[model samples]
Target chain A: MVSITSSRLVRGREARRAAPALERPGVAWAIPGLVFFILFAIVPMAGVVYLSLTRWDGLSTPQFTGLHNWWRFFSDGQILQSTLVTAVLLVGNILVQAPISILLGVWSAGYQRNRAVLSTIFFFPLLLSTAATAVMWRQLLDPNFGIPPKLADLLGGNTDLLGGQKGAIACLIVVTSWQFIPFHTLIYQGAARAIPLTLYQAAAIDGAGRVRQFFHITLPQLRNSIITSTTFMVVGGLTAFDIVLLLTNGGPGTDTSILPFAMYQTAFRTYDYGYASVIASFLLLLATGASLLLVKISGYDKMTSTMEGL
Target chain B: MRRRRNVVAGFAAFAWLLVIGVPLYALVNTAIQPESKYTDGGPVSIPSAVTLDNFRTVIHSGFLHYVWNTVLVAALTVAIVLLLGVPISYAVVRGRGWMTRGVFRLFLLGLAVPSQAVIIPLFLLINRLGLYDSLWGIALPTAAFALPVSVLVLSGGMRDISASLYEAMALDGARPARILVNLVIPLSRSSIATTCVFTALQAWNGFLFPLIMTQSNDTKLVPLGLYNFVSQYGGNVPALLAAVLMSAVPILIVYLFARRALVMGLMGAGGK
Candidate 1:
């Protein structure tokens, strides 16, 4: 039996070694994309890094600013404020939105007929472009001409939802969460569907309640999926642009400007390319760091091992 | 056993439906209502009257040109992404060496680095290239930006094809190009379609790129066109909604047809 197992392992190794040699060239399959990314993406990023160090109004020649932009960025209260707002949005989206989606997804995944209906409705926001959705919701949230106050009045008192200082920020989060929940639900449902039913049966046999089973079996098993979904939300929130652009334009007097919009305002609105590049670099650092952290948190070993089939 | 679960799931799903369905109802309802009602808007319970009047007004307002311009850009963006993206993905997937892997990682970096961060340098790059105010100008940057994900998807799809199939064709003394055309192309149709839908939607709904990169109506895409409308006559609620509706139609049509793939594709594309 030992000899037979050893012989089979040797044969597997031999087959793997021979396979590529017998295979047609794979070089063509991979070079064009590699070259394209190197030229456009890598080179451009280098250019951005270089530009971040200089003072250029974009049309004129760049002058070396020698960390002036960086200094200004670090010192600026507005930048710090925008950073905080961005963090708030990111955290809020992940914290508030993720659990709701998990609940909804688990619910949706349990039944076929209901799954179809729920998915269709939940994904409508995903269909609407950010501009249209924002405009639509902007109207819905209008103080004088919107639904929130009217809905509130109908319930016996009037209150404005969009006019509060933090209300707009909350509204932005709500919209983003609404649009994003369907995608998270879909992803989680996919993960949940992949979980074995025998595990559930065993839990039932052990007389575990639904809540206990969910905590023990579902949540632990869904760590990778949850981390991935939350990472997208975090990165997405950090780069939040259009919805904020369309809904409030970072307004109620610049209360909603995240790092991305701040980068926009610095560049096009302010026409300070150098300063904008600095902001861009900061955003780049933040996004890259967050992504790397997510990869780590999601457990790289498990992902890499399982990623072969995925 | 399944029956009990289905009952509870069915109710939960219905609740989910109401959440997304209601807002959309409100939006479509607001568009058809009269201007006074829109401005005096409260809870928009129902449409007071049906009118193509708002749609007519939007079309007559010369947004037709804007609509045309946007379509032109999106089409060009898709065309460019496919043209360049397919070959690039082919190389990244089948090519040899650490350099290939390194270059692929650079594209991954693009996913993390949002376009807003680079808006300053990107605008400079576009202007200096003398692409300012040209449809190609918007198309080029959009395509360049979109390359990472397109290549990612295509390469992932390509990786799924069996090596033996390519080998069989090669043994027949088929050229490399022939093998890719016959095997890789056919095998990657679903992924390619998904990528195309994605690139088109991104280009269609792209705002900041067009806003900074293009100055006038000549190169303006739909998002820019809509933004311009809002800046101009945002107070004209019905007209704005009508224009918004017009701008959304093409994408909505595409979305309606490909909702499943589009939704799943977006999740997959972003998940990585």
Candidate 2:
């Protein structure tokens, strides 16, 4: 009993919908990527776990010594300290970077005239590798010639930034934020643009001020992007190696030495592949567990734009 | 209300600009200055003498060769990611049953795995393959790590193609391959670009792989080269900063010429 006027429209849609089975690729199409990914990614994941149980140098075959490295890893005071430092760096980075990225992301999403120019300037940091950013800051953090001495009083006369644990950690966060905020901001910018202007206009009519509109409207609208950006931050923070290596070298008697650095120092410097693999295994678990937690909590796996229902 | 809000936002933006700009300004200002004068004025002061000597020093130190190796790695990485990521994404989007869905989940799981965590085993694997100290060794694992993101972004793009478009192609008797060639690829152009840009950046800017898998100067990528520069130059701040700037040149050129495409590609990684 379709209306006569809509009969043609219905028929056309029906004609198109009936062709679902056409051009469906088989499971074989996925084999190449699967094989490659498994060979490189999955195999290594399993290998790290296996290596944790073995004693081996780079030059020799691994000897199976069940849970010996694990036992040592737990007892090791440095590992605990490194774990604490890693946690602090991770939390500090998020605290510093997330709000800055969200604010900049929202601000840059405006249709104002200078947004594009400012964005391009902001995009400069992303162009530089973490190595370069760290190196440049290393020079700038130099007590005599860098910004530290010039602003010695503001820093409470602590010009030796990389010397103290707290200062070193602060420097690491600032550097990490500087290098990475632009990327997350870009993510938020895209999400912010997808938000409807009508929502704001409607809120205005309800006597909501701009700040209220942002709190009630823009913040809620950016929920998914917030999750996405924070997820990246977590994964990146867990495996943070380069900046730590370049900027601090896990210095001041390994006080700033996070897990990855400790693992590298064990494997390459001390040639203790077995213990290194223990740290590696711990890193693998932490990274995957944290990401899984974030995904589960944020419902990020069910990724849809905030505007999906609208 | 609008005016006042704009004022606050503007002031914040200005302050942020300085935060971003000052470091960059310091980087450039220091790079052009001769090493002797760098400490006299410190990082903030205008250079007493602007010279290309720092850049010259970088070039002479085999910057171009390292750049070439990096380019090779970036190219190989982009090629591998696209060749593998596109088909799998297509299969994930259109193919039926549990296998494809599981594969998608595997990649989602992989999004958590970082290259550093796997480097020890990756080192052993690369050694077992007899590819240690080779560019191929670095490129292979780098591509592998980038695959999850590649698949995620590409599949996101492929899903946007209206079912009607696929049906139209099917109605025209197009097989899966032909439909992929004729319809899917064209529609997925932006995603492919995103994949290309992202993977290229991953490879180009990669550090840990090259650090562990390849040690020799011949195989050293740019970031690794920069690592060496820190030791070799030894407090030659101007020369070191110049090298850092050089490491960014190729991608910076891409960023300058193809900014919109590069930006859109980065935005695509937002997984919307």
Residue pairs in candidate 2 whose N, alpha carbon or C atoms collide under 3 angstroms: none
- The i-RMS of candidate 2 is 2.1
lDDT string, candidate 2, A218-237, tens digits: 99999878887887888789
lDDT of each residue in A204-239, candidate 1, tens digit only:
888887789889999988887888888888788878
Q: Model 1, which residues run further than 4 Å from truth?
A: A1-36, A153-160, A294-310, B5-15, B39-41, B270-272
Candidate 1 docking class: acceptable
True C-alpha contacts between chains kept, each model in order: 0.52, 0.75
Residue by residue across B69-119, what tens digits does model 2's lDDT show? Answer: 999999998899899998999898899888888888899899888888888
Error of 1 at B249 (Å): 2.5
Q: What CA root-mean-square deviation does each model show from the true structure?
A: 7.0, 6.0
lDDT of 2: 0.87
